[model samples]
Target: MPEVRIKKRFSALAGAVLAAALVIAPLTAAGASAAAPVLGTVGTIEAATSDGNHESYWQARYASYNATCYKHSLTESTVHGAVTDGGKTVTLAPFQSSWPGNGWAALIVNSGTSNNVIVKPVAGIAYASPVNNGGQQATVSHWIVCKGTLPTPPSVVTPSLTFTPASCLAAGAIVFGQNVVWSSVKNADGTTTWTASPKAGTVFPANVTTSWTVPDLTKLSIDLEGCRPTQPSADESETVKTTFVCAPPLATITTTTTKTPYDVWDTTLHKWVAGTATSSDVVTTRPLTADEQATCEPEEPELPTTTVDTKPWVDGSWKCGDTTVLQTREVITTVTPTEGEPTVTKTSEQQTRKLTQSEIGTCPLVPGKILSACVGDVPYLSYSVDLPEGFVASSEKPVTITFVNGHGGEDYVVTGQPLSGKLLWPGASDAEPKMWPGWDLVDGQYVETSGNYAWTRLKDVVVKFRVNPEYETTVTYPEATAECANPALTSVTPDDPTDPTDPTGDPTDPSDPAPAPSVTPTPASASTDNTLAITGGTIQLGALGLGALAVLAGVGMTIVSVRRSRKA
Candidate 1:
């Protein structure tokens, strides 16, 4: 509301003294005349005319001022001096309005004065003339004696204030195990700050109900008389209020758990190796021992084996004896008992017939009586004489048999050869020789010594001894002439040699045959193959394979394989 600048008219020039000012504006009075009010008092409040708004405090006051209000009502009126802005109410001094109805009231105060007041008529509604409360006309008469505008001020009152205890809480809360008690505050200016606490030495449980006392303002007092006449005065003490608190809900609680898993192991390295982890809640691992590794990973195989059968041996046996072999074999022999006596019908085979020249059994030179001869060479005649009447044969020392050939050729050896005692003798091959004794009757003992005979060298040296290792004993041969020409061995019937003349003057002693062999069996031959060294080592390749092959070939056929190898 705008300040009313009262221009005193000649008739109203009765009185005017200015010190401070205020203008009271209120809500409208429904539909009454809003004319510029005369110097009349209506409803104790003016309408909000086309003026600006103002708060309850008259900030425009320049100095101390005297205020008065007149009151009259059909009921005891409670309004002191208040206004409403429709939604909110402003209060002022409760300075009692002491006059009777239509009488007067007054007060003295400085600028910035404040007080509590009743907002309006209580228990009933009332208003002044020309301003009705709602639809009812003024059952009450009210008026205010206030300055409207600022007076040129030269007077001022100043006072200092101190809030001694500053401020306090309205409550205390249990923090941890102790109560955070709040203290009260009081100012030297008669102001107070209210607070609450568990009285001294008092404690409370957590989250307890708690509160603080609202301080009594009436207990407060102000002194303005001491203020110098030129300073602002302290009006009244203001009330400060703060909230209280007890223990809050207990602090939030929490728990934690961790998770993990274990691991496994492997094998194969003879040691433990790792495998996939075993899953669990907590973090974990484990080393695998040999036993555990067997269960965890694929067991490492016995480091795989690779072998090459290097130099497999070729096993074989001669026609005469068994030899060493690499593989295995088994032999079985069955014995049968006969009900009757068994016959040993042994038909012995003879490889040689007793040889003779000119007469049978004259020279008596048993071909293999003591030494061997190559049986496959050209047949020849060799002679020997029996000891005369007082002589004997002795084998006390080693005797050697050397071979000499016709046509001034070299000598050769027939040891370890396939020789027959009665078969046609073989011819000499290329080599050298030393001579051996025919016989020597020394000290009544006949010793066959070796030395060269001082005789004319003969053209041909024939041998009559042969030896065989394959066909032992059951050996036979055909007669042979000394000729191997045309290379076609001529077939000749096996005939016994039968030429033997007397041992005359100079014959038979110097060119006698070597000592005869203690005769053994010889293999069968036609005296055709001359180079008979060793023979018949054809292996039978296991009787099992041979039988299987023969069976597969249907009883009449056999399978044989021949292969030649060289020895380095």
Candidate 2:
């Protein structure tokens, strides 16, 4: 609303005095045409206004100016003034304004005056005029007196609530708690009213009635809604019952189970080894029932078909509980009665036989022998010896056997005597070979030893032979012969050895074997960054040759693999 400035027509002296009295312009009734308002009864008040918005204070004088209202309908009266509740006093010092036909009444308190008044006039507070001979005089009955000091209202601090997540329950629930302390004020009627004013970062709980258990503490916050009760109740001191609901904790738990097969005690290895059969599974949340647990257990193994002492196989049990695994196992032994059994006494046997060419075995082929290094292979021989008549080899008395061989040549030689028993071979020079024991065949493989006799399980019986690798030009290996014998047990049959020939040629033809791939050694040059030392040769393949070497190595490995597969 725009402020309406009312101008009072006064003499120059009176205007100067009014201006000196009040800094702000004074308000008056517009177009009154009557003498200035005569000051009526006056009194001072120390009071405050209690409007719906907020409280406001005032300390000012009230007086009756006795001005006539231009419009006098009780509902539309545009005349107003400040007075007591019954219109006893009114004053124009704290002035007012009125529009003749606009039906709006306003009071403008002098902010700069010495009266010490601060008031915002309540809107729509209008007064009716009294009947008179000329016009109705606006009375002061409609004006409300600003009275009685409003005592300083007590400060009410509302309790607050904060939520913090925590593990409050035992494995099943998630929860939170509240902390509050209510303040109260005693009313004149001997009744106590509880109130709260929440601070920042807090929320007042809504008036709810759902209840839940919080394990940490007992007391909970209840909103009684200040002076107003949520329900109709005559008792003012009873505590109100309120409740709230918390969301349930949600989670997904999983479990995985694995079963291993039972182990068997190996008599020869003397250790446990995994068996061939078992069952397993993985599960989540779903626990096995009694029948499922029984059905999933490993079945008992059948008895062994032996009438001797033996260890029984123990089958273990396994099952999945709710998010847990359970297993059990036990071992037992069994013994059989032994009374009427025939104990056969065995005896040792020394026999002599000639070993055939096939029994002596062929030497293995050497592949990719580009170097002049010595190489040897322990051939797989058949050590099948026959027993003497009417006597059998048993666990108590096994047969004793041995093998021997001798070799010699002009250019190269293996000149060891049969059964001299020393680890010696012809040197690089033309010296006689020293006595040498053949390799022992232990666990189906030949192992070198310094003994005159050979294990009965030995595969081959032959003299150790060597070839002179000092030939000036590329040369083929020459044919040679040797004799092998056993003085105490057996001798080797001297079958004529077949001359080695290339599969595509005649045996007697004097042609060189295929020239093996050769690499002539050369000093590495200063510019070469990559060098590989391979028997008598330093390959200078530069930087890019690393990749080339990798490719060639792969090709060589593939060729060797193909050759082995063909031999197999």
Of candidate 2, the 10-residue stretch with the lowest lDDT total is: 557-566
lDDT of model 2 at residue 151?
Answer: 25
Per-residue alpha-carbon lDDT of model 1 for 1-568, expressed as tens digits?
2323323362133111111111122233444455333222223333422111222232222123322233211122235443222212222343333532322222111111221122223222222233332332221122222322223433222211222221232222222213444555676665444444553444455565444333333422112222112322221211111111112211121222222222222223121223333222222223434543343234432221111111211233221111222332222222222234332222221222222111121112222222112222222212221221222224322122244443364544344322221212232211112111232334433344332221111222333222111111111111122121011222222242212221212211123332332322221122222222233233222342233222211011112122111111
The superposed Cα distance between candidate 2 and the true structure at residue 45, in angstroms, equals 13
| Per-residue lDDT of model 2, residues 1-568, tens digit only | 2322233343344445545533322223333455333223222222223331111221222212221111111112222433422332233222233332221222222111211122333333322222112222323222322322222334433343332322222222322233333455655654344444444455555663223222333222132122122332221111111111111111122222223433444555343445654333332233434543343324423211111111222223311111222322222222212344433332222323332222122111111211111111111111112222222223332322112222222232233222111221222111112111333334433345544332311222222211111101111111111111111122212242222212221111112122222321111112221111112223322332222222221011000010110000
lDDT score at residue 85, model 2, on the 0-100 scale = 25
Top lDDT: which candidate number? 1
